[model samples]
Target chain A: MAKISVYRFLSAGCNGCDVEILECLVPRYKLADLGIEVVERPEEANVLILTGGVNVKGKEELLKTYETINPPKIVIAVGNCALTKEIFDKGYPMVGPPDQIIPVNYYVPGCPPRPQAIVKAVADILGVKIEEKEDYWLAPEGFRGKHEFDREKCMGCGTCAQVCTADAIDVIDGPDKRIVRVNYGHCSFCAVCQDECPTQAIRLTREYHLVTNNRQTTMVSNEVDLLSCSVCGGTFIPEKQIDWALKRITTEKVPAYSEFSNEILSAMKICMVCRRSIKNIREAKRLLTRLSEKVRGF
Target chain B: MPETVYIGPYRPQLVEPERFELLVEGNIIIDARLELGYMHRGIEKLFTTRTYAQNIALAERICGICSGIHTLCYAQTVERLMGIDVPERAKYLRCIYMELERLHSHYLWFGILAHSLHEHEAFLKIMGERERVQDLLEYLTGNRMNYLINTIGGVRRDITPEKAEKIRRTLKELKPLSDYIMSLLDDNGAFTKKTKGVGVLPRERALDVGAVGPTLRGSGIASDIRKEDPYAAYDKLDFQVIVERDGDVRAKALVRARETYESMKIIEQALDNLPPGDIVAKPGEPKVGEEVGRTEAPRGELVYYIRSNGTNIPERVKVRTPSYANNFAILEMLKGERLENARAVIESIDPCFACTDRVTIVDAKTGRRRIIALR
Candidate 1:
């Protein structure tokens, strides 16, 4: 029987992949139980398991290892970085895929592929198809293709807007009429916003349908009505989101009503333009007061 | 004449040196010269191009075992730059995940240490038990690995009452198993024989070399990032930093073993006092300045140096990983040790190759310089 040797390679990638690779080879998954052994040098290796994404500095060494390894050597590209350069491939100095940099026979995908998956990939490369029933215990329901926001369901309370990754969700129109718009392209479907939604308005449906024939249409936006003021009939948005804007527009400039009068407020159900006009009038009054005080001091 | 032992992927060849050297005598290795730069990846240079938000995910991929620590440090650094204050609840969550990561990382190291010592049964047993912790992490965070839980300002997810209950139940199951494992650490004679005094990294050497985490703790230098520089909710949690007096492989193992118990205690306390509030805090972009964020990773202290130019993208993102620093002490640890003890010694430091790949090696004898390979 030929002695089977394993060469675990990491290419300027995260150390977690290497640790997981070690996990696969160790007694937990026991790659050696099937007569596999980890060799220190690439020359003594029969199966080369390449972990991590190829960084600029590590590319030369990676190419050298691929060239040095003997023929009939099976290469397994493990983890998302190695398979597709996943997160790091955007603008990072990635050489290419593990197969592009070297001759790869098998590919396992995961942020860091589980030890079982890695072990399975190795076994498959060795021409030994180890059949194990797929465990469906932890699998989420549906063919969810990442996460997509139902713009209609979003309250635009800036809850999802606050936690969005793609900077996809933004609360425009100040806080009162704040709307959420998602850049679908930037969304990885991690569904963090959906999970953190206060009103349970943003939900990640199992529907994995996302299409982008044009860049302009990739962003999906939804507007929501803000909680209006009982007295002024104006949008009294969440205090938290509008604190920055409010700091610029002082309380004197903000339209106020005398004695919380709903009758006077009902007559002034005006849009933002009219509301700004009313606010300016209030500001002019405060400026007059300040000027009078200055004149008296003089 | 000393012969160079060439162990290549193609074939093994032994060639005599051009000069008659007294360094090598037959099979006995008088001096060993390591050849690195077989794998290199320019990850640091790449960070400059990525946005600060994007870099959090990117940094997490630097090392799988300590991905949580990497993301935590990155997030904390960005938060500091942005002048955002994380909620009390988020801090506790961060501590919980950090301790859980420490548990799994130490368990992983234990398995590796046992494997290197050829204690196959113990290795399998330790790893098989580690799956429980992984399950807990998976249950809390969506993914088992690369958990995108940490974000700028605060965490992305929150553990609810139901989830906390589940965690409590799981901890109950893990407690006895962990206690049993701790008992076995001292009782197992074979385990002691392989680790005891095999690799002795002195306390002063550990401090001078700037070793962090369990490696420094094992050397009796009580320098823990959690204790010294409290980040997340570590300051709130009640747990001791485990330290051992002897700077041997056994002491390192003992540090990790005791830390596992401490980690469990931290998780319990965090879950018990879990606060109810928003998990994330919304804040503006960071100002132009340099800020440092550090966390105690499973291996040691993982530090991230971030410089923001008042833009979404950072000007520079420099990571000083625990493994990267700890790996520097390897040559010193291996100086007087035999070739057979190399694997055990490496495992003792909980060497993280993913973290160590950033190191640039310069030859002392010659002016030749080489970068450590990732593979």
Candidate 2:
């Protein structure tokens, strides 16, 4: 039987990761049953579980801890903040992520990854076989995980970015076209994007094991073409949005829109600025025709 | 032989960073001083970059155990600044989550303190029971530790009858475990003797040191922010403040246990009286102004001050956690106690010091800089 001892050093991140670690030790998970013990001194520890993003003051202590442990020591970064610093990586007092200061052997990521994830990370390091994580616990029905966009369905109106609760989504509408960029590191897993998407293009999947030493691999960028305004030369609505508008105007069951002809259907493709001017000109012609008929009758 | 022993910068086996200097004479302590910092992440500074809608996620991360209340308290502060009217149904849902948080936090503290006293079985038992609450929270909010259920005007999620039934069932099942633990704490001589009169803070000293929540109530104050300045659906819930007069470690434990009972009661009443309506009231941009918001968290009275500069993002956000005020009170409680009794007495107050370590201190007597923490 292998005997292992660990020293828990939590730095600046939220206490969520710490709680999950404790949960693993409790009756349900029974992490202790795997021949692991928590030791008080660094010299006796074979593994160091670092559960937080290193803050300014924790920097010196962390370095000392890394040094105090005898060689052949393994360091594990336990949560999303410890892995990438997430959204709280900016501004004063934050030193950096754990790996930036000390070398890390493994990382388990989540806002607070379920206790199972921690167990898996530890077991892999110990070369012990453990069952895979229970997906339901890690992500309940609505728990946000990975951001996925269907390039075929996405019109790239930038509405997903506009409605995003976090600045995780960015929409760039230039002279050319539009694209929505998804920075997974900054995402809070709120899924406001899924709710606000008109084309049902964006989705948050239940693949919650997002731990990565490098964050660049998790990002997503989807591009789409934009339509030119019928009246002006500037790029207007997304091409897909024009089709959506045409379908809506033609398919309405209401009596007011039942008589819609090809003229009205094509007019829906025009930008709002041109649509308004055309409506004014048509009304002026109708008024002139009415006045001429009245004079001819006199 | 008065010697000052320094503890931490990187405390062993603790959940966060904290430093404490104890003045000891042999096996007895003569004086005590605490230095917080060591975990400050400048979260308050990070708030300026996020809009009011996204700030709840940051506020929820303030502390792991008291995650729900931080977001609830910040949401209140932002609501006050924006003058948003919360829906009636949202108020009751908020109350349910708040009480649930208190229940889980007390259980966590009880388990950790049990471990500190070297009673490993009791520690495992209490922590095991805490999972019931965690699972319930997960079912309701889709996350376990930080619920992140609150938005500026109201809550992000609503409770259905089925989920409410589950919570009620869990509470019913937990009542017996809570009772068993409380009874054990009251009768078990092995546990009580070490905790009973080891660190006695007089009622005056407790108030003078600015202790709040169960700590102050343990010293016979009977003061609670829920009753004093009611927020959410607390005004509707019929509950009493749990207090005791002994002012010792055991008294603090008893008060928290009783508060757990009261929290259970509050949750039941709130759910029973839950009104039907919208869960959130979408807030508009906040005007340039500052407002302080208050809530009774699991530990004590939590306060949040928010300043908005006529934009979606706030100009500043400051948090004053209950652990900060109660932390100073432990120093007075530790004066003249046995050196061995230090850990139990400090743990008894549920000193979640990591959440309140914002202020920087340069101690003249010890000539050492103390940085508490920002939970």
Candidate 3:
């Protein structure tokens, strides 16, 4: 078998992916040991490895480099930016994902995919088997890897979506269900979502090998049941969210609030709009004002 | 007769997309012009669109090598705008991370410089040592490149006793290897001979051009943002600002090589006197005002100026990266340099084109820049 020559083309990114690609050459990963050479020019290369999102300038470079590479060339897009444009997609200068610019054979996903993951991609490209070492698949402790969403634990408060730096998490409030979709293709894996999660539903698990040929393989979505307004029959909030709130109310020994917890819970069944119109109801209004006072105290 | 040579829009030596046009007569370069904007993603404009929390990630992405410093500077700036006091422990943690980043960045620069000089053995050895530092960073803050430990008010992560122990142990192991590498620079080997008198940036000229970090220090300037401004735990910690007198490629290498020791020293001090408290403060809203945040990134002084509209998002954000300042002085250094030494000289300053080409409105009258699209 001939030695594999890889040509790295840097696009418009933070250069995190490039650093990881270079990191593969370190003695630990031994990209060189695997009979791979990082050639200086595209014309001298068999595989073209591109890192970063495609901006106008990067797109030009990408197309020019792709054309320069000789026949039987392989193009591997490394990092989230290359696959889905990640956080930089909204930037003014960004051209969409690199795939829209060039034909990518393999997509290595991560904010910047782990060095080992990149090594795996190159090995897979050449149809060479990787020599597994001890702790080969283990990411470091506290490693921010793939995101895990727990449906049972999720209350659909949208805190993960709100605090997401990559804008990777999207919350869709449907009639019967609140769908929270996490696109790993756009995720930076900074774990701000994990940090700000109120119910600890979102976590980055220790599974670093996120490389895929299909873009849809990177998306994980969870759906939560939404409770409808009793009067208006409109979906207001996730049913589990209300249950979590009620559980919190019951656990905390707010004597005044605990005594009238039933009344408050019953009033909470109607949506905010319906509750506004029903504010004139004597019993409900009295309970609401009392509940509001107790809420501030708690 | 003068000849023309183009280095890149794509070159292995250039990690980012950049081009160098050199006009040469025989072996010496008569004129050199650098072409940029290939790596620009309009990060400053993007900052305005994202909220303060999201902007932290944006700031980190400006330059991957010196990523932590950007977040630290941006976080400090927003904290000042909101008048939030970060916890003492968080400050120490921030200091620790900054120093570790400096070590990693310097090691990377050293490896690249070694590789460029055809010192493949040294490059591999240095990179191996760098991976250890990166491992320590990964253990401390999850990821290797963009740590993302910094938040608006304080740091998001804390260094436990085990992580602190690992940092100390790793630095202890690295000290001897780094010393050997520094000694190699001290030697009369091919590496030292090739770099000794090449790409000299005079102290006076460096000062005039407002060069920062190792690029300025290598020219014998004793100034460092950590010492002068005293941000984070630097005011509390003790470490000398390493300076070299030569102002050549070798001097710049020496400055960075020696500074790794100073960085290790600072980290040790911060760790030994680690304060006990919460790692973050309750963040407050930013006031409608303008403020600046500055810090010593691995490459040089990084400044982030911002204006708030009294909202979650900033009205405007302007970044003055170290590479942006250091880039101007390169042409001065390149004027009389040998054509072969051109790449070495440019790499000496560790110019981060990604940091330099954020946004530049060249069209004056219309103030509308054309966006090029591929067919």
Model 2 CA deviation exceeding 4 Å by range? A125-127, A132-139, A150-153, A159-167, A170-181, A195-200, A211-214, A220-238, A241-298, B354-375
Quote model 1's TM-score: 0.69
Residue B72 shift from truth in candidate 2, angstroms:
1.1
Residue-level lDDT tens digits of model 1 in A72-152: 777777665666565555544677666676666666655555566567656655567654554422233321233455654
Clashing residue pairs in candidate 2, if any?
B36-B371, B36-B372, B37-B371, B37-B372, B62-B375, B355-B375, B357-B372, B357-B373
The CAPRI category of model 2 is acceptable
TM-score of each: 0.69, 0.86, 0.93
Report lDDT per candidate.
0.64, 0.77, 0.83
Poorest lDDT segment (10 consecutive residues) of candidate 2 chain B: B353-362
TM-score of model number 1, chain B: 0.86
lDDT of 2 by residue, B277-368 (tens): 99999776687899999998878989999888898989989899998888888888888888677777777778764221132334445656
**i-RMS, every candidate?**
8.3, 3.0, 2.7
* Global fold similarity of model 3 (TM-score): 0.93
